[model samples]
Target: MIGDTPPEASPSPDASVSTGEKTGADVASAHKPSQPQSTESHAKHAGFWALALGSIGVVFGDIGTSPLYAFKEALHAAAGDGVTRPEILGVVSLALWAMILVVTVKYVGFIMRADNKGEGGVLSLMALAQQAIGKRTAVVFTLGIIGAALFYGDAVITPAMSVLSAVEGLRTIPALENSISNELVLMIAGVMLIGLFAFQSHGTAKVGLLFGPICAVWFASMAALGIGQFIANPQILASINPYYAVKFLSEHGMAGFIVLGAVFLTVTGAEALTADMGHFGRWPIQAAWLFFVLPCLTLNYLGQGALALTVLDASQAAGRPFEEMNWFFEMAPLALRLPLVLLAGMATVVASQAVITGAFSLTQQAIQLGLLPRLNVKRTSETQEGQIFVPQLNTMLLVGVLVVMVTFQTSSALAHAYGLAVTGTMVVTTMMAAIVMRQMWKWGWPRVLAFIVPFMILDLSFLSANMLRFFSGGWLPVLIGACLFTIMATWVRGSGILFEKSRRDSVLLTDLIDMLKARPPHRVPGTAIFLTSDSEVAPVALMHNLKHNKILHEKNIILTVDTRNIPRVHESERITIEKLDEDFKRVTVHYGFMESPNLPKAMGICRKQGLKFDIMATSFFLGRRSVVASATSGMPLWQDRLFIFLMRNATNPTEFFHIPPGRVVELGTQVSV
Candidate 1:
């Protein structure tokens, strides 16, 4: 589906063909019926606590590391007017409520319930909405693409900002301050990022074992440090009241509004929780968030607030500047500062890992949905199908991250670029979730509005605040997101036009069969399988073969593969076979968007349904279209050119479907779109 060709279309001419032969016994042995294999066993044995622990590592990594800079940046944003007690309390209260409202209530309480066949994310939600509406509306599709694009924008900024912020902790150490420069920190962070991406190809199966316990330790340390500070100044707990946030925003005017942009950093990674719902079930993520992540983050932020108040009072009394202080690192005991820095660094790396892998997963989904060009996706873990590596994506992310680090140079500067992407994504998520509530849940208008109106206001408010930063490095994500949106839109539009053109050019399957019967071509001994996109039409390869080779096989099969919107197709419903005539069969195979198609294995399943296959005697016929852009095509000239370029580079069907090269025979033809 990632390729330009439709799922039922023949392979491109560039696809490799196999001429290898397998005897009847070999084919029979290769496809022998065995005990039914169940794909649902992976999560069956995982208890609530086990899954919760796993969720802590993967789902909470990004949000958990926010304590590294969220408070610091928010305070810095307010420091220009000389930090006030009301401002500190108000900012902390705003952050606390943002987390409570945006994440706990909106996503955990509502949106997560809208999973598409146990899958959750923008695309999954889009699919659910489309299914409920009985058709794909342009609005829903565009929202999904925009959300996905913004996620990539967020993905690039996350590693650079998180890692830079964590490593910046070293600047707090007096012993290292003189020796560690910003360049050295950037170099170190760059190396860690390089190493992190380089290891993606190896799969996370081995190291993933340590993510849970390590994050557990990280969270425990956060709570301990925060609790130490909170106990020292118990009054800081009063900031939990919404009144402070209201009073601060009311009194400070534009400055307070602008500070909300920085305050948004507290919940930057909330989307990751929903994005990863399919990996760990909803309850596990919810339990982890409510029990461990939420409390730790709350305590840490409160502790940071308490520490900031003390630092502010002391600085005011001493007539010194509070601008130079890095309260996140300063909250730790002086003796443990270096170790804390190392811990924070490791946690940020874990956060980076989560975001990086999330980008990979999202890209795959987009490809399956026909929203992007094909890239070589390598399954890194044999047991963990979700663990995949996209080499092109990795290189692109690495380059983007490095550029961000080099250009921004510091976490404070990069933070200005970070919130826009997250806020934009949050806004889109709220919008899509609203549609789901109204249309899919079939909720009454009053109930839907009651639930979504408040969340929309909250998300839009955050988005508006983030817009204050558009010129201050926020444009970076917007630029990246816009470009990605264009590419996806162009591909989807072009693919649709091309599909229509192919349909118009194709001959009807019945007519082709009838013509073959009337002509009575030189009968060949082998079985011939023609891959096609439309079952209603005969494949171009079949017609081309008859015209050139002047022969027809003893038996013929037309195969079409359908990628469903669901996460996975059940084995029982995978293959559908119909005997069109004594010499011909129409076989359709259904796969989930989350799955990769395998022709041989699918054919093996058909063996039980009276379909016989002898690899040595069977020949595969594939149509490879050499697409050319034409002025009369429905799409604009630029889009037509882009489509042609994408088609030229698409992964050949031979490799994509895992078809045997030696048994493949490709027929080439040129088509103008």
Candidate 2:
């Protein structure tokens, strides 16, 4: 019997196939080059400087803005003992090394190498890792979902914290201090956030053109301010040494350990470098980090440290308190402070934009991979396929950002909740990278341990420090991650169960075709396309149509859309057609997890292959399942209910697959699971 397996299903290791007969394994093997040959050529075409500039704008926004609040919060957290020179050096050291170890070594050096068709993200890496292991393991799947969930939590907090911190600089300006109240700051930040999200539907292609130049100017400003402070006091450069970091830990002990949470913020956006690698390419991101973003951030942090040290010295000499000074804002001169505030505000807005777009891209990938319910995904660019906007996700993110802004009220307050999500994602990325090194890269155990152990220690230490603030505010992200993780896990589990249940009751395609030939029903004169998840079984909609309508179309097509692990499928390999009999044909359409499915466009391609498609004469049949939670279902009662809710809320197949509403027929059926 001829059978077409679903892309997500596990394939036999030794399955044999003839020239015409291709199994799921055969198709996957044909595409799995591990490292595509196009990676180098693609990187070359973009040019190094162009890519680096692009990376600075899109990839470094979150971390680049860390100079605004990270150091200030660290000092505030350690205010119990009062600010000292060694403490200042120690905090700066921690921040610098965190960037070096976390961003430079773990992500840019190693994790970025595990790209799937030059696409890098937690889910993309998950697909690559799973393929290497020869099957999907529960551990890898959970890690991917958890990483993705934590990313969403970070997404919610970043816009609120970044823009709020930047705009709060208004209060620091003596001229605007009395005019801008906390309420006013919130109003402005809220407006900026709303504007950002509102502009998402129109897409980022045009605005993105300006991000590079604007971010370049922002980073230059950061460096200039920092350099001015550094030139005034060269002693702060000593913090670059690891000795201060060690002395800090030795002197303060547990208190110093807790400060790591704030320091972790210095590298919060490091993950973006890898996640956005596909957009800018690896060399450009790496080059931008090493040559541009990293240097600017380091100098800024050093300058902030130098300024703090000078303030502490003055306070000690004059017998005053050190609580009044915020080195980040103090670094700017009185005359330029207002303009600096404006620049910082724009930079933060850029930071927020990157994360919001990332959330949209992640949602699209999750939905394509079947880990999420279908959402309305709209492409924003004609040339850049990755440019997309999900309206539902944008609205939810805006609401979440505003809620966090209102509740936290200040960037310092929001900082506590921020580290948990960022650190959690970093730790997960480290773990996934370890798996990739061992399974995909085929590194020796010793080599893997050497590379992964240090990163794990750093990530876990940061995560543990953030956990100390759980009661303070860290629990917000934990709560958010838990909820999102549950949703993703439930959807994946529910879909698997439903697929199995549906497949069990389905008639085999070979058998159905043979039966139809022997006892044919009344033949209708138009083409009919039945969309099915699995091509081996007859579509439920086809069965329902035959059962009730009592007629078979003159030409029937069983259509199955399979999402591959790669980022995209070439047009030549996009559609596979099999003839079971002259009256019936089984067609499988292939898409990548990063690509959207367009049934009409795919059908047009099919037309070139002798499969005729007439929009007016052809009808697309889809099965609309009304799912109910049953006590006997495999999932727990709560999860079953959640799955039912998600299923109901999911976008209709007609809209999701781009099938014309006028030419589509949906047959509804109740299914208990």
- Top-lDDT candidate index: 2
Local lDDT at 376 for model 1: 73
lDDT of each: 0.83, 0.84
Tell me the spans in candidate 2 whose CA falls farther than 4 Å from its real position. Answer: 1-46
Give per-residue lDDT, candidate 2, residue 274: 71
As a whole number from 0 to 100, the lDDT of residue 501 in candidate 1 is 81
C-alpha RMSD values across all candidates:
7.5, 5.8
TM-score on alpha carbons, each prediction: 0.93, 0.93
Candidate 1 least-lDDT 10 residues: 9-18
